[model samples]
Target: MFAALSAIGAFIKIPIGINSAALDTVPALISAAFLPPVYAGAASLIGHLSSSLYAGFPLGPLHLIIAVEMFLILFVFTKLHQAGRNVWKWIFFIVANSVLATLPFYWIISPAFFVMALPGITIATVLNAGIAIVVSPVVERVMERVRTHA
Candidate 1:
């Protein structure tokens, strides 16, 4: 249910070159904060692919790359949440995920692929992470209530 809601949150989009800022990151984070890491990854995978496909996502296989990136970041964040750590670490993961994802593409996409896309992707990811941080506590509380009552 929550993952589906998160998927709905992914409907908005702000295209950045080939990649897009579809605002799915926070919902993935919400999934991470409240549910298991696997669910967060699953939500990201499902939400990203589903919405992007439905909207006629143009990046083709690149969408899979971004999905993996989102999954990695949110999955790591779930571990952090379990440890009761600061959410700001998401910034690190965001940047790291971008850097890692931008690899391989260096040879395939373009030699300058990382140089061009890194800045925009990092900015969007960090922004999404910030939004996720702001809403995580509330999500946690709500999920806690649901779990307790369920």
Candidate 2:
């Protein structure tokens, strides 16, 4: 089920070029919401690596960046869930994870990846983060329903 969902998300791209696809963080967020943090992080890592390998991204250092992003996001979500925070708090957490988590990576790799143009990195971060923020509530609600039904 998780793999299928992730595959579907991979194909659903946003119009802008900030690499906003339905695939990137939603699976990670969902896994984090329901599973243990370690499992969620592992799921995220596997899902991303699978997607990248299938889609043909430069997998060298990018894997490290993705691992960091997934771990941070899952850690934040798990902590927030434990703290009994509201949805808005989770949204903020997701946004922070998306931006802050990727910044160091972008900073480190931009010269090699982006030729020193930070705007592309910033734009990608914002768009991906924004999509995650926007999609979070819906995912939460769906999870809630599933939990209730189960």
Most lDDT-accurate candidate: 1
Best by TM-score: 1
Worst 10 residues of 1 by lDDT: 87-96
Deviation from native of the Cα of residue 42 in model 1, angstroms: 0.7
Model 2 C-alpha lDDT per residue in residues 58-103, reported as the tens digit of each score = 6576766776676656666766665767575457554555456556
**Residue-level lDDT for 130 in candidate 2:** 60
Looking at model 2, report the run of 10 residues with the lowest lDDT sum.
Answer: 112-121
Could you give the C-alpha RMSD of every candidate to the true structure, in order shown? 2.8, 4.0
TM-score of 2: 0.62
Clashes of each: 0, 0
| Model 1 accuracy (lDDT, Cα) | 0.73
lDDT of each: 0.73, 0.59
Q: What TM-score should be assigned to candidate 1?
A: 0.79
